[model samples]
Target: MQPYGDVDSTLRAIAGRAEGFGRHAIGGLHGALYLVTSLSDDGPGSLREGCRRQEPLWIVFEVSGTIHLSSYLSVSSNKTVDGRGQRVKLTGKGLRLKECENIIICNLEFEGGRGHDVDGIQIKPNSRNIWIDRCSLRDYDDGLIDITRQSTDITVSRCYFAQHDKTMLIGADPTHVGDRCIRVTIHHCFFDGTNQRQPRLRFGKVHLYNNYTRNWKVYAICASVEAQIYSQCNIYEAGDKKKAYEFYTEKAADKEEAKSGIIISEGDMLLNGAQPCLLTEYKESVFHPSEYYSTWTMEPATHSLREVIQLCTGWQSLCRPVDNMVMN
Candidate 1:
């Protein structure tokens, strides 16, 4: 394992240079990083210290080995963690960020710690503008990802998950007033499963599109609330023989009322057993429905011109080295 001082100094130096250049976005109070050596060492300790300093911090694991957490890593708004790829891994029950906004977590591997309530990632209670990309979370007792209670403007893309109790869970806490739910987008992800989940969804607007699933699982997607959750071009290979999609709601209403619980906009999807099958979720629902026994395919591709331009213009510019190139 790399010594914590080496990593911490490098990050601090970057923050310092960014400050000297007057790039507030790259520095200022939001630029500090928190280095957590091991999950067993003291994660909340690092987080508490960062909070005390009142800076935007990044939590990194020094040990490349697996480190499990007793509870979730409670993150504040506008903070991010860069796993530096899979060099370091956090094996935990899960991560829970409550009432936080503008959180970005990328390039890490998560092993869901043991417990019924364990989930790979859980965003809760008015969290908004959260982005999770290019991560792998697996071996959990519950769903890999779960969102609840008025959390809005969240996106999870380009992630890999397998051997999960259930893949995705979206809904409202029901007990909380003034905490209803709204928009969430999930796309370009992979799920490998063969079992069904309980209480799939309760309330919210969700978009499930172009996701690839395997193992002939019990379900691909579902809903059970008041919203428009749609699935477009999703590929599934459910082990079952039924080609028809399943829509389950506690209350069966007329067409319009039925739409309130779990709504499906587009259901016809093709699958070919590939990876990262271009999924998209453009709407919302609690008890949404999904197709089964489908397959999809995916592979890494070189960048296109438009993609390169967008990448350069966005956050890429901030992380690029002084030499004007992204380091591998």
Candidate 2:
């Protein structure tokens, strides 16, 4: 089986269909193609130059290797960095998505990043309509992916997270009341032995479904400061640590007192004597993802979920022929 689908459906995987909150992300489907022929940090025909371009582009790789970034590569609006064919590993610094929209990132590998606060993908400051799918994220200085500073309408699906501290953060901090606008969907992901924060959310409405989280060091998921999370049909297995879900109390910019967030769970399988710590009393309401959109696929969190996650999540080698040529 491939990451997106089975091997037979690999031909149809190029359709930029993002489920859940980011369903409107077109992601350069109507834009021109820009082939990445070089593996340099920044130059002509390089990935960095194509990302820096102002116009909409569907960037694909022609070669297979590591791209050591010197700094965070600033990506523009309406872009799709599709690494379906090539085995592209990004190290050093990572990609920064700041104040941009309609982006899709697929099938890339994010490994050892050495610098401070260097995430695999940093989406911040009002960026929206993003879909990060089928990517492999591992060690970094900070997080694998962070959606903060009011960035909203994102969907992260079928991705693999491993060997990292603070794997993902949905809302930035308690300092930003603007984070109240954040809405994200995380589905069909495999969090394999990651340290913490499968996502630590603050003031965001997050939907987590059909994922397998195993062997985490600190905690599997967190909600802080007015966040609302709906976890459905996910399998959470523990190693040594036991808190599958954790909450932190923090005073936000607009709060009266310190408050940990709320979580509403449905059909979640917590194994190996895991604890769901301090379940919140969401007396008002919680955001249900099905109320907004319902095209997403899911199954029950059975023992078969472990096998499915191990086989289907992460980068897959599914290459198809391309024709258009629009260079930078």
Per-model TM-score on C-alpha atoms: 0.66, 0.93
Q: Encode model 1's per-residue lDDT on 202-311: one tens digit a residue.
A: 55556555455545455555555443455554555545523223445543232334333444535434334322222234333233422311222222222232132223
* Index of the highest-TM-score prediction: 2
Q: Name model 1 segments beyond 4 Å from true.
A: 1-29, 43-54, 60-62, 173-180, 197-199, 241-244, 251-260, 265-268, 271-328
lDDT of 2 by residue, 189-295 (tens): 99999989988999999999899999999999998999899998889999999989888999998768998888887789999977864564663477777788966
Query: Candidates' lDDT values, in order?
Result: 0.50, 0.86
- Backbone clashes (count) for model 1: 38
Q: Score residue 50 of candidate 2 by CA lDDT.
A: 92
Position 283, candidate 1: lDDT: 34
